[model samples]
Target: MGKAKKFRGLKFKYKVDGINKQLTDKYQTIEEFLEAEFPKNNNPLSPTGDTKIYDVTWNTHKVSINKIVNTLSDLRKVLSVDCYVTNTDIRLEKIKPRELERKSTYSIEQIRELTKEVLFEEDKRNAKVELDGDIIKGNSQRYQTFFTKGIKCVCCGIEGKYFAKEKVYRDKSYHLNLYAVDENGKEVLMTKDHILPKSKGGQDHIDNYQTMCVNCNVAKGNNLED
Candidate 1:
């Protein structure tokens, strides 16, 4: 589904990583190693034994060098039936149409065709809309409560840099925001509360702490998913 890759040895010119590198580096038999991996939009290398290279979604940094080799060995197990290393990109094969016609399972292309049809009708669903009045008031109520309730982070008590416990909320208050009273007698200080956070189960109940200071609470957005 990502990019086209070539099967080694099927194409004489295309080279596997270590296997081809020795030839190119030691004997200078080839100018460079032909990168053969799944073709993503970024790479130009092809598996057809041609010299073109291509980009694949696999990020080299996130995976260790040994892990990369291990993954390649794993892929080699099913490379022939599941994927094709191409000269321009890796081409993966879908289930055969004849097999789909005879099977009870949903066809592989059904989602693709449905997505196309939905996209075509998107404008009809976007017909029209209207709204009235603006609501802005109870913005920072819960955030201010953490310090009010005197609760601290469960892991580390409020003593230092992991200051959630001392403050009962998260803040990189190395920089503090100053608030001056407005002409209308309103305090212009606006902050948010962090709800059930990534550190916790992330429940949205009142049990969840609110963080004030837009910058303070948002530092822990859904990023916990990472």
Candidate 2:
């Protein structure tokens, strides 16, 4: 129903370092001198990989906050990522967006829930069905559209029989491909979206379907409150 969620990445490196005057003061044990010069470097990307530690002399000993921000800002300008001069800092410069963020129209679990919910939501609405007294037409045949057709996104073009249920959303004139066996192998006509929506007095038991692309489907959202 909405565009796929996007990820916003915010990243920059901090020094996490200190000063070194080891040349002026000599130490007998190399371990003592090394510990004092490079106090923190225990981070390991993988357990089996070589560990790298940071040392004071790695830079000009003048890596400023402003400099790091400027570097990150330059990268943001080049890569077209979001950047800013300041956030909710303690002194109006400390707060910043988290290093990485992802936005979603639905959560993973909600998506799983909506996989079926979006399709079924229409059928459950208080919309009335035309019928003869004590006799409902096509419910029996159309209720079983899943078994008749197959599970796929009736909205987006992504297709597969991976839907959780087969029968539930069949009445929607679901999106699909039309196929037939040919002289040797087979022939397939691309499936299509409905030019008319069933909710807008269109036939639920239609004999023809029109393939709708993702952009078109989304663009046509809620024409029948689609």
Candidate 3:
């Protein structure tokens, strides 16, 4: 016979996606959030709370699969929680990676329905947005890749287009950062320029490039140094 199930009953593993802060901020902490959302009897963590009896990591929580499938479908989609049946013979390591994985043994129809629901909720959230000046602010996460690398303008030290307004907004709010505008408060266009002149045999590549505002780029055109 197959080895006895690790869990006596069906088990589910879950992790919440951290993206929209407004939705997450509604709950002060992760523990509070889970307690309020899940049944009181299922206490995701141990009584002492120092260690998780069911969770593999701080973020991953475990529950009886029946309880979640019966009750938490709507909540899971709203919170963007990724959950899967954990007592299955198959494992994630056995399958190719998926952008989003459905519960093991779920039908293709079920997966499609769940995927549609998630997409609908995301589109609904994205529809609600407010612009701040030149910035098209929204719940969507962007600039994450560059941020990981600490990309910033070498000249003005401006981190990003969004960072510009946050740094220079005065009174109520302004559109441009101090470094992005001139003395007259006019917007300064920006571009990539060569630190060593291309005509002077500097290879045309990113290694030779530097960030420069339009005014600075034009003023220093064809010259090796500022």
Best by TM-score: 3
Error of 3 at 82 (Å): 72
| TM-score per candidate | 0.19, 0.19, 0.24
Evaluated with lDDT, which candidate comes out highest? 3
Clashes of 1: 33
For candidate 1, write residues 32-115 as lDDT tens digits.
122335464423233322332111112111111221222322323323333233322333333221221111221213322323
Measured over all alpha carbons after superposition, the RMSD of each candidate to the real structure, in angstroms, is 23.3, 25.5, 21.8
For each candidate, the alpha-carbon lDDT, in order, equals: 0.26, 0.28, 0.33
Clashes of each: 33, 9, 0
- Please write out the lDDT profile of model 2 over residues 52-96, one tens digit for every residue: 221111111211232223222232222232222222210112222
Write candidate 3's Cα lDDT for 1-226 as tens digits: 1322222212233332322111112243333444454434434322222221221111112222222332234333322332233434223221121312222232223323323323223453553332232222221122211222233445665433323323211123222221244557664544556667655666544556666665565567532121
Regions of model 3 farther than 4 Å from truth: 1-179, 223-226
**TM-score order of candidates, best first?**
3, 2, 1
Compute the lDDT of residue 48 as modeled in candidate 1. 29
Q: What is the clash count of model 3?
A: 0
